[model samples]
Target: MSHQRARGQPALVYRTKTIIDARGHQVAIVDTENPTPVTAVFVPQRSSRAEVAGQQDIDVTRMIVSSDTPEVTSWSRVSWDGSMWDVVVPPAYHHGTRHTRHYSIDIRRRPS
Candidate 1:
């Protein structure tokens, strides 16, 4: 297990990721440099809403703004699943060149 700190918060973040299709089926497994603390399955769009709605395992800290030429937008939510605060990148952002939907999990230290 790996450990990460989110800034001023004493909470530690454990990161794990699940990749699912639009129908909510696990399509691919996300490989990350972060340690797997707890496993959580996620759905795109709706999942972000759930976290914002305060119904799930993580809190959203920041939304990432990606710019190529036209400027693309992706969201990252920092949420604590009790043990760790995780930064989850949901499927709305295209992680693949040919794909528009895919998810990745990352860890961030809250800026002190």
Candidate 2:
């Protein structure tokens, strides 16, 4: 009998690294070459739209539902629909009563 937990890999998540420049200033560089590929989906949060409704704030929020890559945090970023988004909060692991699990990460649109 096979007893392997099924995991899916569907998308790529880009991450940035902080490095000190010659002036000793920290610089964040995005690693687009070696992205972390995982099974994740960016779900648009209703609160995000409602919050920005009739407001000057252009920020759009989303919940990244992933079955893997629990390490993804506020330091991570994702490119979707030709725009980059920044993670706004840490991952929230949800454990269902039936033993189901997933990671919920809140992300906001990166300002230009």
Residue pair clashes in candidate 2: none
Candidate 1 lDDT: 0.32
Most lDDT-accurate candidate: 2
Residues 39-99, model 1: lDDT tens digits: 2232233223234654544323432222121211122223343432335344234354432
Model 1: clashing residue pairs? 6-110, 7-110, 58-79, 59-78, 59-79, 60-77, 60-78, 61-78
| Residue-wise C-alpha lDDT for candidate 2, range 1-112, written one tens digit per residue | 0011233324557777778999999987766676775555556563433355465434655554535563565678876666677777777878654335666777677655
Positional deviation of 36 in candidate 2, in angstroms?
A: 1.9
All candidates: TM-score: 0.20, 0.59
**RMSD for each model, in Å, please?**
13.2, 5.6
